[model samples]
Target: MIDVEETYIENRVMVQPNHANNLQTAHGGHVLKWMDEVGAMSAMRFAGNSCVTARINQVDFERPIQVGDTSLIKSYVYRAGRTSVRVRLQVYRENLRNGKQQKATESYFVYVAIDDDREPTTVPELGVSSDRGERLRDEALAGEGQ
Candidate 1:
């Protein structure tokens, strides 16, 4: 019952020279790394505990983001289990000059909270307190093929 909008978080990072590949575009590894980091944040926020990646459901790259473009990554917790949290992430490339933007990638990640002993820990029931939360939950459920 997490508030989808409240769980929604966005982070922007400038594509640095080191983050690019031979083609001068952001490397796939770099993009995945960023997505993992941001997605972990969403899971941690929902679980309120240390979490580890259990799986990456999918990652789709729609466009390349070149160096000097801003990479805006958005993440939110979409579903939860006793010890697992599902997070959805989206990446966008922003053109600073014209203020244009486009989706560069999208991904879904799963994480599980662990206790001090490194065993899976239970998590609180997600509370869908708002319409946005219900909508996100429905979307996530549908994506699960439920």
Candidate 2:
């Protein structure tokens, strides 16, 4: 089994002009790409094998991340099936200058583990022994489908 906390992954990207749209805010696609990458990392950590995105739940952009800001992406594997890992992904906009941050986007991604032959493989069960892990898992479960 893999602890939920052990599957956690965080990444930060500096929003640049190239990442921004005409309005000078980070494009939704870029944000989603970052989320997917981080979510995959978390899934791989838990599955101990390569993973492929099988589905992405609703993604709502709560706020726009302006250029020159930092995009903080966090992900964790909250649930694991026999051959799949479910990850919760969230993105935040941070103003490094002032050290302020706000939620920018959130979503859930499901990934299926694959073996070297590119065939679906089994994944270990998710473990939530610590209070922190349980709380995180509960939060993710409650927020699912919302």
Question: Best lDDT goes to which candidate?
Answer: 2
Q: How close is candidate 2 to the true structure, as a TM-score?
A: 0.98
Q: Residues 4-123, candidate 2, lDDT per residue (tens digit)?
A: 999988899999999999999999999989999999999999999999999999998999999999999989999999899999998999999999999998999999999999999999
User: Which is the leading candidate under TM-score?
Assistant: 2
Q: Could you tell me the lDDT of residue 86 within candidate 2? A: 94
**lDDT tens readout by residue for model 1, 1-146:** 45666678899889999999999999999999999999888888888788999999767789999999999998888878899998888899999888899999887889999988999998777777888778877777676542
lDDT agreement with native, every candidate: 0.86, 0.95
Could you tell me every candidate's TM-score relative to the true structure?
0.90, 0.98
Question: What lDDT does candidate 1 reach at residue 105?
Answer: 84
Candidate 2 clashing pairs? none
- For residue 140, give model 1's deviation from the true position in Å: 3.6
